[model samples]
Target chain A: MSDVATRLDVLKTYKLYVGGKFPRSESGRVYEVTDAKGEWLANAPLGTRKDTRDAVLAARAAVKGWAGTTAYNRGQVLYRVAEMLQGRREQFAAEVAVSEGIGPKKAAALVDAAIDRWVWYAGWTDKVAQIAGGANPVAGPYFNLSTPEPTGVVGIVAPQAGYGHSLLGLVSVIAPAIATGNTVVVAAAADAPLPALSLGEVLATSDVPGGVVNIISGRTADIAPTLASHQDVNALDLTGAIASDGPGAAPALEAAAADTLKRVVRPELDPFAQDWTNAPGTDRLLSFLETKTVWHPMGI
Target chain B: MSTVAANAPGVAGSGLQDVAASEASLRRFLHGLPGVDQVGLEARAATLGTRSIKTTAKAYAIDLAISMIDLTTLEGADTVGKVRALCAKGRTPDPTDPTTPRVAAICVYPDMVATAKDALRGTDIQVASVATAFPAGRAALPVKLADTADAVAAGADEIDMVIDRGAFLSGRYLDVFNEIVAVKEACKRPDGTSAHLKVIFETGELQTYDNVRRVSWLAMLAGADFIKTSTGKVAVNATPPVTLLMLEAVRDFRAQTGVQVGVKPAGGIKTTKDAMKYLVMVNETLGDDWLTPHWFRFGASSLLNDLLMQRQKLTTGRYSGPDYVTVD
Candidate 1:
C-alpha cells in the first residue's frame, strides 16, 4: 500500500425531491435498498402517505406558474435538463448498474437512451400543440380554434418491476409530463430508485423551476395510494403499481382515483411484458393533456 | 384617569390600579416586570409546535380553531356584499356540513360593522371591529376615541384598538396607557354595557419580547378585556415567541390580580398546522381554562378556510385542495 492516506469515497444521502428541495421523508424513515440479487446497496428514504400529500401540494402550487410558461420556454428548459443529465451520465450509469443488477455497458446504454428521450420530449413541447390542436371550421360568422393545455398536476409511478429499465422508464414518464407543462409528483421505481433520485439532482441543477417535477422513492403502496386519491392530483400514471405491492395494487389505485374523477393512465396489461425499450410516441405526452377550444365571432 | 374599576373582568382589580397612577409609577411598574429570555422562549415554542396531534384529536382541534377565528375583512376595498359573504362564511363555515362550528366573531373595519351586524343579526357570533384609526394608531387622542365610538355606534360587540407605538417607544408610558383607557371608555354604549376592548400592541413594531411582555401587562392594567398581538398590517406579525411572552404575561397577570385577559395572535398565521401550534402552546401554557372562544382567538381570514380544509380531510380520507374551498 502507498504511504499516502487513501481518499475516502463520499456517499450521497439520497432524498425525496419536492418543490426543488431535497428533503428526507418527514417521518425520518429509511429502508435498505438492494440489488436485484438482494445485496444491500444503500438506504433510500421510506416516503410515507404524508410525503405523497406534500408532493401533490407542491405540484398543484406549481401548476399555474409552470403551465403559464410559454411552450417554447418549456422546450428550452427540458433541453437544458437533458444537457445536465448528459454531464452526469457516468454517475447515473454506475447507479443503474448496481440498482438493476445489470452490466456496466447495458447501464451506460440505458442512460444514453434516457438522455435522448429528454431531447425527444423537448422537441415535442412546441410541436405537440400543432399536431393535437388546430383551427376548426364553423358555420356562419364564427371562427373556432382549439389548443392543447396541460392536465394540471399529474402523479406518475415509474416502472418498478425487475425487467423494467430504471433510468429509461423514469425519463420516459417524467419528460413527457413536464414537456406538456404539467407539474408532476412521481413515485419512482421502488426497487431501483437510485437512478431516479440522481435524476432529481439533474433536474434541480437545470432550468426546471421548483415543483415542476417532484420525485419520491419508497414503498409503492405507501406513496401511490395517497396520490391516486388526492383531490389536488388531477391525473395519475399507474405504471409501477402493476408489479409493485403485488397484483391488486393497480386496480385498487384505479378505483380510488375514480372517486375523484382523476384522468388515470392505467398500467400495461402484462407486468413482465414490456422491456421499456420500445420507441415512445406522443401517447404519454397527450394522455396528460386537455384540449381547449375557443370560438370568436368573425369581424366584418 | 389612572383609576380602574376593581370589578372589571380582565383588568387586575384596584390592587394594581395605583401602579399606573403617574408616568413614573407606570414606568417603574413596567420596568419592574421580569425581562424575557428570548432564546429559551423561542425554543420552547418550537418544541410545542412539533407535538403530533392526529386523527380525532386533529378533527376536534380543527373545529375548535374554527370557532376561535375572528373571521376578518379589514381591506379598504371591502364592500357590503363582501362583508355579507364573510358573515355567511363565519356563521356556516363549511356550508355542506351543518356540524361545522360557527366562528367566535366577525371582525371588520368600522364602516363594515353595521353591514356585518345587519347580516349576522341573530347569531351568537360577535361583531368585532378594528378602530383607533386602526393598523396605525398615529391619530390624535380625540380622533382615536371617535374611531372607537364610531365602531361601537355601528353595533360592534368588541373594539380592537391599536396602541400608540411611538408613545410607548419614546418612554411616554402614561400616554399610551391613558389612550388605552380612553378607548376603553369609548367602548361604552347607551344600554349600560361596554364593547369588549381588545388592545392591539402591534408587537411587530414593538421589536422585542420584553416590550411585548411589558405591553401585555400595561394593556391588562389599563382595563383591556383582551390583549391582541398585532394589527395584521406589519411585516413581522404575531410570531410564536412574542405570543408566548404575552401568554406568560397574562398567566402571571391573572395570578396576581385574579383577572384573565384573553390573547389574540393576529397576522401571518394562515395554515391549520400553524394554528394548531398556537393552540398547543395555549393548552400547554394556560391549560383548559383559556381554551374557550371567550378567552382565546385567531385574527385571520384565510386561516378559517385552512381549518375547514383540514376538517374536510379528517371527514373524508382524501386530502383537500384549494379549489374545493371558497375563493374568499
Candidate 2:
C-alpha cells in the first residue's frame, strides 16, 4: 500500500444496484469471496431474480443519458475510464493477481493492455461509425443512411472456470459493446469472480454509472440461460459459452436466444496472438445493430 | 503551329540551360495568370523535340506516360494459360502470314526492358516506362531523371515521370516544373528516335477542381505532349468531375493554339462500362478525334478482360463463355 493510501481513511460501500443507485439485495443475503492471497475482500451481497430485475431497470435508466450524449463526449467519457484505470493501476494489478492466479507483473501488464484497448476504442467511438457506416446513395432523392449504434441491453456469459484468458475475452466483448452505447449484464467468469467483481468496483469509481455494466458471479451454465432467455435483454454476447458442433452446448443457447433473436459472437476457432494495436472494427460494431429508417415530409 | 521544334533543348549541348529557360517561361506564364486554377504542359518531355507549344487554358494538362510492367498478377499455371491465350491474338490472319495488331508495346521494369525490347523488336507499338519513383515522385531529382534516362536507354519508347506531390503541395510549383523540364532534357536518343515524355499531375491530391484546372494549363504551356490524370496511387484519383473539368481545358487549349495534346486518365478504371463512360466523355466533350489511341489509352490490367467480355457479347448471341475469358 502507498504510504498516503495507508495513512488516509478508506471507506467501504456495498449495495444492490438499481436505477443508478445501489440498494440492499431484495433477498437480503451476502456471500463471502476471497482474493487471490486468500484474504476476504468484500462481502458481495447475493443477488436474487428481483435483484436482476432491478439491475435491468438501472440499465434502462442509464441508457437515455448515455446514448443521448454526443459521440465525441461519449468518446471522451469512455477515454476517461482508461485514465482512471491507469491511475489506480497498481490496485487492479494486485486484485487481478489475486483473482486471476497470475504473477503481479503479468497482471499489471494485462491491466495496462486492457486499459490501452479501451483508449483505442474510445478514440474510435466517433470514427468507426463514419468509416464502416455512411449515407447510402439511394436511387431517388430520399436520403438513406447505414449507421452503427447501441443495441440496448446485452446479456453475456463471461468465460468459465480455469480460464483467466477468458477474462480478457469477456472484457473485449463488454468494452466494444458498451463503447458503441450498449449496456451489459455480464455473468462473471465462473470460479474467477474476484477479478470480475474488482472490475465492478473500478467501474463504480470510473464514471461508468450504475447499471451500465451489471456483473453476476455464479454457475455460468445455470445463470446464463436465464439471462439469454430474458425477453427484455436485447442481445447476447456468448464468448463465454463453450464451442460445440455438439447438440446441447451452443445449439441450446442458440435456440434459446432465437426466441428473442439475440446477437451472438461465437468463440474464435483459431485464436492468434492478440494484435491489440491493430484497429478493431468490421467485427465489433456489426455484432449488435438494428437498421432503422425514418421518413419525413421534405416539403409542405 | 508545329508541335515538334527543329531546335528542341536536348538535341545538342543546351540540355540544362534549355531546361532552366523552359522552366522560367513556364513560371512566368503561371505567375502571369494569378487567377488560373489548373495548369500543366504536355511535351514528350523525354524526347528531344525543338518546338515548345504554349496554350493557355482554364485547366492543367498533366500528360502521364504509363506502360504496364508488372504481370505477376497473372500467376500460376492457370494464369500462364491465360497469358498464352492472350498471346494467340498476336497475329492477324494472313494466307501470307498476316500479322495481327501488336500490343501498344510491352512495358516492363528496367531489368525486363531488354526482354521487352527483344519481344517488341519489329512492332510499330512503342514501349513506355514509369520512371522517377513513379506514382510518388519524392525521389532525388538526379535519381529520377537518371532512372528515366536509363529506362529510355534500355529500350523504353516513352518515359512517364511523376511530379513530387509534396513539392507541389508545399507550394514549390516552380521546382516541379523545373523537374519535369530536366527529365525531358535527359531523354535523348542517339539514333534520333527520341523517347516521348508524359508528366503525371496526380490530380486527386490537388484537392480543388480549380487547382486541377490551373495545373493542367501550366503543364501544357510548359510543353507537355499529353496531359494525364493520376499515378493511380492516391485515394482520390481520376473522378469524372475532375476529368470533365480537365477535358474542357484540353479542348479550349487545342482550339486556341491548334496543338492537340492527349489526355490520359490512368487509375481506378475497371470494366468496359467504365471505359465506355470515358470514351463517351471524350467523344462528347473533346470530339471524335480524341477517341482514337493517339488521344486515348486505357492504362489498366483488368480493362482487357472487360473489353473482351463486351466484345464477346457484341459478337455472340448470348454471353456464352467461361467466368474469365481466355485472355486471347
Per-residue lDDT tens digits for candidate 1, residues B1-112, read 5545333454444367678778888899899888889889999999998999998889889989999999999898999999999999888888878999999999999999
User: Which candidate has the top score in TM-score?
Assistant: 1
For candidate 1, give the lDDT: 0.89
Error of 2 at A113 (Å): 0.7
Give candidate 1 regions above 4 Å deviation: A1-6, A162-164, A244-248, B4-14
Q: What is candidate 2's TM-score against the reference?
A: 0.41
TM-score, each model? 0.97, 0.41
- Residue by residue across B105-185, what tens digits does model 2's lDDT show? 433444445555555456565666778887678789889978988998888877777877787676666677666667777
What is residue A172's positional error in candidate 2, in angstroms?
A: 1.7
Model 1 lDDT at residue B81: 99
- N/CA/C clash count, model 2: 49
Candidate 2: segments with Cα more than 4 A from true spot = A1-19, A23-25, A30-43, A161-167, A243-249, A269-282, A294-300, B1-328
Worst 10 residues of 2 chain A by lDDT: A269-278
Second chain TM-score per prediction? 0.97, 0.71
DockQ scores of all models, one per candidate: 0.85, 0.01
